[model samples]
Target chain A: MSITWPLFIQVTLRLLEGFETTCLIFALTLVLALPLGLVISFGSMSKFKPLAYITKVFVWIIRGVPLMLQIFVVFYVPRLIWDLPAFSRFNAVILAFVINYACYFSEIYRGGIESISKGQYEAGQVLGMTKTQIFFKVILMQVVKRIIPPMSNEIITLVKDTALARVIMVAEILKVAEEYAGYALIWPLFYTAVYYLAFVGILTLLFGFFERKLSYYKV
Target chain B: MAFLEVKNIKKKFGSNEVLKDISFSLEKGEVLAIIGSSGSGKTTLLRCLNFLEKADDGVISVDGNLLFDGSDRSTTSDKNIRRKRLHFGLVFQSFNLFPQYTALKNIMLAPEMLLKERAKKEKLSAHQKREEHEKIVAHAKELLDSVGLSAKEKSYPCELSGGQCQRVAIARALALSPDVLCFDEPTSALDPELTGEVLRVIRNLKSSDRTMIVVTHEMEFARNVADKVIFMSDGVIEEAGTPEEVFDNPKSERTREFLNRPGF
Candidate 1:
């Protein structure tokens, strides 16, 4: 039960590598999901019946199933259906993460867009702006302002969910914890929670700063 | 041809036919006011003129451009429709300004982007573009001055009152230099004192060169400002005539019931 300071530092450094992977997935998923969610929200709210229905159904299916099932499906479904080159486990993990978060983000997208009055659209059109221009210049920032707090909450959750990647042995942070635990035991497993809580705390501070900076915006 | 025209326009929204074969036309400088009870399609009809809501049938041509040609909705290109849309300006029931942008930037954006292509088409040089920016920004300032909101030039929408927001919305619309201006309940979201402020701004634009169409519930304002009044109910024009003709005379029971309300 003797404390081992040098080994502890090494274990922390090893865990840092896993934390980097976690941050990578977190950042990439957000980079992909924000715009993808906007596009999905647009399609779901489109005047075209077919595109609207398709987007809605797609989001619904992704949201309905558990993330674990989505992870398994992404890993196996393409190979089963196409018989093409198998995807790397990392690719499957990203695919599952993107699709799952995109759906959640789409609902936030939809809510933010819908909360804007139809009058805004009319005003944009009357000003001779195209629909796309209106969405970006007028509707876009409002949607961002509206969705940020909710988006931040979901995003921090996504940071922790990177451990879920370990379910498929993707070698993310939790996997790094278990690896160290086999050699040393006990506390390393508990140490994994510290990384998550610290990451989430940082995320919360960032979101608070963002919201304050955007305070001038009013719908 | 009239400067703007709406011919036999019909619009239905999800089993609700809101406008049935409505037709209207306007010269370049006239102001037309539309008054009706709630669900009377006054707003819907105004929306159709700008192609904000596409009419299920008939045509709305602005500045002689075919905005809606009664083709299958799928066949109509949004791109083509948008080109015609630049011909009109609109103010809404809620002051739908881009809340994040300051009043100056709110008015500057559409002109900067949409008219950048326009400037290129006209082959203006960079010096001319810079000059145009100064002129536009000044014009926007002048517009706010006319509307009594010049002091609020740098304020966000949240910092302004509802009336001031509506005035800024009007200024933003005017910055487009559109052929026609449309108001959907300009005072509906304002308090009485604020409503007077907004209506005063709209009233001062009486001598403006552009045409105007208003969907308003303010009978006194409409009776004073409008050359003619078009009454709507149940997705159709219940009656159309001068304010005196429609408000004073009894043509349709619906219009009668509307004007006879405690205030009107």
Candidate 2:
């Protein structure tokens, strides 16, 4: 248990490698989920009863269950039901995270969009803009401004949730720390806090910037 | 033929009737003011004309072009409705300017979209599109100037006062150059002092011969500015005439009582 430069550097490098995986999962989940969430929100809000109901029920199921269990389901259910080869642990983690986050994000999107007063739509209609034109041109930015605060909260949560990837042996940063702890070196596990805090700190500053940029308008 | 004619415009909200057989006509260069108590359907009538609400039964014609026919489903298609909506621009009482855009961009947006569409249809070159966009900007500036908001072009709706925001909304509505402009109580959301500035803008618009329908609670504004005044009660026109006849010598008991109310 001697504290040495080599041991510190080795632990740092190993954690950095695992942190890369964490960052990848977080980045890819966000890139894929944001737009997919919007589309799902539209489906939930659709005028078509069946589509809306089905989307709502799907969102309901995804949100009602625990994320870890969902990961297990995603990883194992295909093999169980279809007799197919198991998906890579990383892919399963991604699939579960995207589906779960997209559902949560869809609810946030729906709330932001529906919170806009009817007057805005009426104003656009009276100006002779089509529904599509009205949405993209008039409503979209306002919705973006309104959703930013809530979206940032969910996004920060996603940063922490990347730890869940370790359950399926995806070997994210926390898992690397756990491996060090198993060697009876407990301090390296506590050291994982530095990486997470730094990552969340950057995200907080970025979201703050966006919120300020959109502060020119009040929704 | 009337420049704008609405025949038997009826609207209902589930079990409740909001507008009942509301019929009126406006000649070019005239201002028609509708005065009514709340729930009397004045706003609903304006909404129907602007295609914000589809009247359960009606025929609307602007400049002799039949824009809406409730009996014929063909005329009520989404594309046709949007096209017909261009004939009437509505200014809401709440002054619903797009908050994300500046006052000038709020006015310019619809026209910019329209010009872009037309440019695409005519296969105009990129330079021509830019020229058209410049024209739209110039026109929006002119409209802002007309509403006495020339210096506030860069201000967001949140930055502007209620009256200034309404003026921007007025300019935004005028940017489309509809055949008729409609206002659903433009001053209702403003303070008594702020109300004067917006009312002044509407009065100025009148001298320039803009045809307008104003649904208002301001009895004085209605009486002083309207060429024709309509008194609505219980989803019907209680009285319709020149301001003198309607306000000074109301024919219906309801109209007379409404006019005598303390605020009026």
Candidate 3:
């Protein structure tokens, strides 16, 4: 079989449109998850019993369910249960990814926070720092540094999982390939691997740079 | 009431009483050494006065202002007692210098944020604030000089030796210039040789008019620098008196036996 440049360009342009959707979901999830994860971590660690319990239970439910199922539920359940108009397909995909990743990030947050010794907290108190000051000024950077490796792994996984949105025909890269494959030739289906491998490849290097920047943490 | 007073202070960990009716007082500039074996509740008493432990039942006063009564340790309405704590400084055995911060930032943190947080910052004019900041830096330098850590300002805690770390801890404590400095086993973490190095710095502090309360096992330190000595055991005061009277002629059998031993 011969490699064809003209056909490649046609598929690449169509794939690019689908790639744009993937990028949008990735960007939105990060913006939402970073702060939302912090809020969830705080809730899980709250001194009040009820808030802590509720946060933990919510995290457990989200984490236990499949992301594909969650996407379906979040996208379709409101329409089914309430007989209301459904959210836009793109919005539903974003909402699902945000909720899923936030739970994962919360666990990473909890593990990072718990890894720091209790002695550190007592030391902060002895200096007369309020609990807020201790968390932000003392423990915050350490948690960020500690959570990066696990968070990066999940993020790369998230990039690939954007293809999961194609399940609902949201026109992700793979779905774009499916359209072109049926029309022109089936080879574009194989070409979809090019986009995925490239996306994941770039993310890997970005995480490497991020980890190097945080090397001062030493832990 | 004395310059610093503790009355009926009790601390318990779920029914295992760490301190029972612990009471003591100190005049300004006096060095009172609290000596006892491990688990004697010596550290607990010091923690109580600072409201670090939140005593189960107690009344504590500093400079004629009651700090902790029953449960709450002086709310915003009780500014006088709050003022007293700001005047108290604590040094610990572990040196507790924030691992992430430089020594200079560690010393400057409390005075800078604490005053700003309490809104007493208006007392300092911009010129004075800059001057005060410079003075804290200068004083932190002097304190580091006094404790023999002048070369270690930029180093993190992990890079420093145990002796250097303890000196930084002392510098961090003295940076506040509190009315009283309370040490909770300050030398317990160091070897015998390094113990002398820290004790020498502490002995140098004796000539100044600052009040000090030292929780220690070093009998010689208690005898050499203390104006008064307190021996505690099993959550209660066993004996307390002038250094000479307590060490030279101990009244309690417990004190005599404890002093003669190599360890407290």
Candidate 4:
């Protein structure tokens, strides 16, 4: 019960193990969601009314409801309705996180794309570049440049939101801290904050680096 | 047949007709200047020539090849439209250079892409394609030299002045080797002091055999460079003739009124 440095190190290392799971959820969600969001954004901005409307409504429903509820549904609904086997707990958490974050990222992508002036497209067209060429070569880099700040914000939030996986018994850092708290080890609970702050701080620096790299595009 | 021609072109946006019975023809090596107040459809007419705005009714022929027969979409196949677009290049008033690319790359991109497309069409071997690509890069460098921006080839659009950016845009347009080059008030976006640099570039291009259609407010430059001058009023060609006839002795009352207006 003595608050020894060695004891603190031992607890921190154990919490770091759980934090690895949190980091995995965050990284995988981002890797899967970023491009998925772009595809979804295209659907939302489709010229076809039925397609665009359907995508908008789907995004609206996902965003309107709570993430925790979405996780619960993702975890339990398939087996309940179809008498099918449930997904593994980690996979269920990832599925919920990917769908939820992809919708948010889609809105950011949509805004970034729409904010570009029509002149850029016209310029590309006049240069005899095809629509695909224009989108990839001219528009995509600019969109990336414009969306990075907002995307970083969402990604940082995702890092914190990974704690939500504990609701499904995923044993992420917060869950590990909760176990310690149950044993009257209150200090370990606050220790999780340092991990989160350090992770978020590194992400902030990384995003700032990206913003600087894209500075050549002043518009 | 003229090198480029538009027959009875008409365009309307909603209930407002922007171009009414517009028609013009340009011979190879001709420099035609279109002059009008804002809303006179000068820019719209230029855009129509590039197929940026499809006319409600018209026929456009570049080098006597029909690029558009507005009533028939099937004849204007996507491939044909794209091929025909290569015959004309447009420089925007706003410059419209890709902000992310350096000046050299801006000039080089379309040419390189088009060369690759052409290589596919011609079924060239890899060695032949590399040789052809080298030629394009050489031509792109020549274009930059012509625009007098050889020193700033590596500068992005934001790093360049408005005049410098416009010049880079001109170089980009020329890199495609179009039969005709069109300008839409190329200097209007520049400060008064910066206008001369761009106008000088355009003026140097006047003697070249590349057919040019310039929509400009600089009456003096137009008089000096244009083989033909058109006065547009209310979406129609009020008068058109040699520069001397249009500027010094305008036949139409509207043309005279516009020419005589203060600050024109």
How high is the CA lDDT of each candidate model?
A: 0.83, 0.92, 0.81, 0.91
- Every model: Cα RMSD to truth: 3.6, 1.2, 2.9, 1.5
lDDT of 2 by residue, B1-264 (tens): 999999999999999999989999999999999998999999889988888778899899999898888898887766677788888889989998999999999999889888878988999999999998888999999999999999999999999999999999999999988889999999988899999999999999995457999999888898899999999999999999999999889889999898888864
Poorest stretch of ten by lDDT in candidate 2 chain B: B74-83
Per-residue lDDT for A54-87 in model 2, tens only? 9999999999999999999999999999989999
Compared with the true structure, what per-residue lDDT tens digits does model 1 show for residues B108-147?
A: 8787776577788999888888898888788778877877
Which residue pairs of candidate 2 clash? none
TM-score for every candidate vs. truth?
0.85, 0.98, 0.90, 0.97
Two-chain DockQ for each candidate model:
0.61, 0.88, 0.40, 0.76
- By TM-score, the candidates rank as 2, 4, 3, 1
Docking class of 3: acceptable
Candidate 4, residues B18-137, lDDT tens digits: the string is 999988898999999999889999999998888788888888888878888877787555666677778889999999999999999999988777787888999999999999888887
Q: Model 3 misses residue A124 by how many Å?
A: 3.1
Q: What's model 4's lDDT at B152?
A: 93
Predicted model 2 interface RMSD: 0.8
Candidate 3 chain A: worst 10 consecutive residues by lDDT?
Answer: A210-219
Per-residue lDDT, model 3, residue B113, is 63
CAPRI tier of model 4:
medium
Which portions of model 2 miss their true places by more than 4 Å? none
Worst 10 residues of 4 chain B by lDDT: B74-83
